[model samples]
Target: MARNTERRSALADAGIRVLAEQGARGLTHRAVDVAAGTPRGTASNYFPSRDDLISALVGRIGERLTPDPTRLSSHAARTPDRDLFADYLRDVVRRLSTDPHVPLALFELRLEAARRPAVAKALGAWRQRAFEDDVAFNDESDLPGGRTEIALFHYAIDGLMLDNLTAPIDSGLSVDAAIDELVDRILR
Candidate 1:
């Protein structure tokens, strides 16, 4: 099958939607083709196997979740302090929450990873790469947090997103306030 970047990306996006709506079990080449409104076997042509399709989904998720460089530059232009860090956190929350399906799809992938070692390997690599990239960005921007602190924040973010996206422990919780407090208390 000839490679089509645009169609491949569309299929990947459709795969994400299927995963988000129907979960990992529902993720299939046919499902992706259906979601993308492409002909049957289109997704299979793009991703020959389930693993290949999953790998494509993982890469696409990273691309979709990447923080905007222009926005990051704006944040970096400000003082590299706790408040600034909180602002970055706010941006993260905004990004994840704005597109609820993306995070939901990510959660589905993470769940599938626990059962399938192949999925785990692919997902783990993507996560590790993202973590390293975030750490590098922090180091470059002279952020207050180091590796350990960033790791802590990463853990906190996962929990926060899971809770907020699924069923929040507190329905009336203010995410911004939580982020502010997290920055104030977590970052030194």
Candidate 2:
């Protein structure tokens, strides 16, 4: 059983590497087996279908993006620090830049989820949970735009991620400057 699990993990990691380097269409059990250094038939032993393999791969990637609810709750206990937001933006950008494969995996999973209802539902649940927490944290009571404004603010961030993933993002903008621009736009 342990050996089987190890083989499964190896296959999943291999799949990520393949998808990252060649995109989703290039993924195959033979490719993953070669990448993982496992026997050609090893992938089939664990992942009987391509969808099954992809589901595992997507779940693993999604887990990375799913924020810990408890962590946000703990942060909420402290007073808002403007500097922290800048730090977070910097961290996010750094991660995006350094881990180019992460966004690629995310894009593949997101696109696949669009075609599969079950996958889409799961992704939607994960996204909703994350968005709910953000909405709770940034609640602006009686503000004209209120939650809609917050949602749009988040939408812009998502758009930024997609744009950066699609093209080389300029390195000139400091994280603080970017956050300040976002805050300025949203606050007004």
Candidate 3:
């Protein structure tokens, strides 16, 4: 069972790399096998279809991107709410800027999900889980406005991420400044 789990994880990681580098068209079972350094037919054994593979990839990407609670708590211990929020946003943008492949692969998955119902269903579930996690995090932090604030925060961050990922231009505002502005608006 452990070996199976490991192999699935490896394949999912490989799929992320492939999706990032080659787009959705290049995400084939055989391609994942090659990227994973596994023998032929390995990816197929785990994910029987393209939808299955994509579903797994979405879950894997979410796992990789979710912030670690211990790290968050440590940072939160010393900072106030607004500063903590800004710092969290800064950290997310920094990660996206540094390792663009994760977000790039996510964009690909999102686009592919549009034309594929199975992928769309999977993505919807993933999104719901993400939303629940965000709500829980905000509640734990004792942030005001509950789910509405969390949703707005997500929208603001999503816009920032989309702009940075798609049309990366010098907006004349530093990332930290933009995050501070956003934090002020949301927390006000």
Residue pair clashes in candidate 2: none
lDDT of each: 0.90, 0.66, 0.82
| Tens digits of per-residue lDDT for model 1, 1-188 | 64899998999999999999999989988999999999999999999999999999999998888899899878877998788888988888888887788899999999999999999999999999988988988898888988888888888898999998887897465998888877878885
Give the residue spans of candidate 1 off by over 4 A: none
User: What is the clash tally of candidate 1?
Assistant: 0
Candidates by lDDT, descending order:
1, 3, 2
Candidates 1 and 2 compared by TM-score, better number: 1
lDDT of 3 by residue, 1-188 (tens): 12488789889999999999999999999999999999999999999989889988998888788777787878768644677767777776766666677888888888988988888889888988889987887788765447887788778777788887788678787768788887888778
| lDDT of prediction 1 | 0.90
Clashes of each: 0, 0, 0
Which is the leading candidate under TM-score?
A: 1
lDDT of 3 at 31: 97
Which stretches of model 3 miss by more than 4 angstroms? 1-3, 95-98
Q: After superposition, how far is residue 40 of candidate 2 from its true place, in Å?
A: 1.8
Using lDDT as the measure, the top candidate is 1
